[model samples]
Target: MWFLPDGAGITNWPKGPTELDALVFGHVFTILTTPLPNNQFAGIVRGYDNLIELCKRVEKDYFEKVLEH
Candidate 1:
C-alpha cells in the first residue's frame, strides 16, 4: 500500500486495475501527519505507529519508473 503523506506523487494509477498487492509511493515524516482513522478503521494503527506494529520487509525498491514519475 502506498503511504503518500505529502499527497503529491503516486498519480496515473492503473486504468482499470484496483486493489493493489504491492505499494509504490512516498511520505515525509509520516508518523506526525497520518492520523489513526478515528472512525470504523480506528482500530487499525497508522503511520509509523502501524509500521512499527507490522513486520517490515523493506528492500527499498527505487525503480526508475516510480522515481522518474
Candidate 2:
C-alpha cells in the first residue's frame, strides 16, 4: 500500500500505466492532507495516524475473512 500525505507528491504519483499498475497491485492507497497545525514536524504524526487507521481496518477485514472461511 502507498500512503501519500503531500499534495504535491500525491499529484505526481502514478505518472503512467506502470505506476498505476503498481498502485493497483498494492491494493490500498491513501491521499491525506496534513492535519491541523500543519508543519514539517506534523508529518510523522499524521503518518502514524494514517498507519494506525490502516492497520485497524486491515485487521478487521482479515478477521472477517477468516471467520467467513
The digit string of per-residue lDDT tens for model 1 on 1-69 reads 333222546666454322341332123224324665543333333434434322132223334346666
Model 2, C-alpha of 67: deviation from truth (Å) = 2.8
Model 2 lDDT tens row, 1-69? 333334534455653235543453233323233344555554544456544454445546545689876
Predictions in order: lDDT = 0.36, 0.45
In model 1, which runs have C-alpha deviations exceeding 4 angstroms?
1-8, 18-42, 45-69
Supply candidate 2's per-residue lDDT for 50.
46
State TM-scores per candidate.
0.18, 0.31
TM-score of 2: 0.31
lDDT of 1 at 33: 42
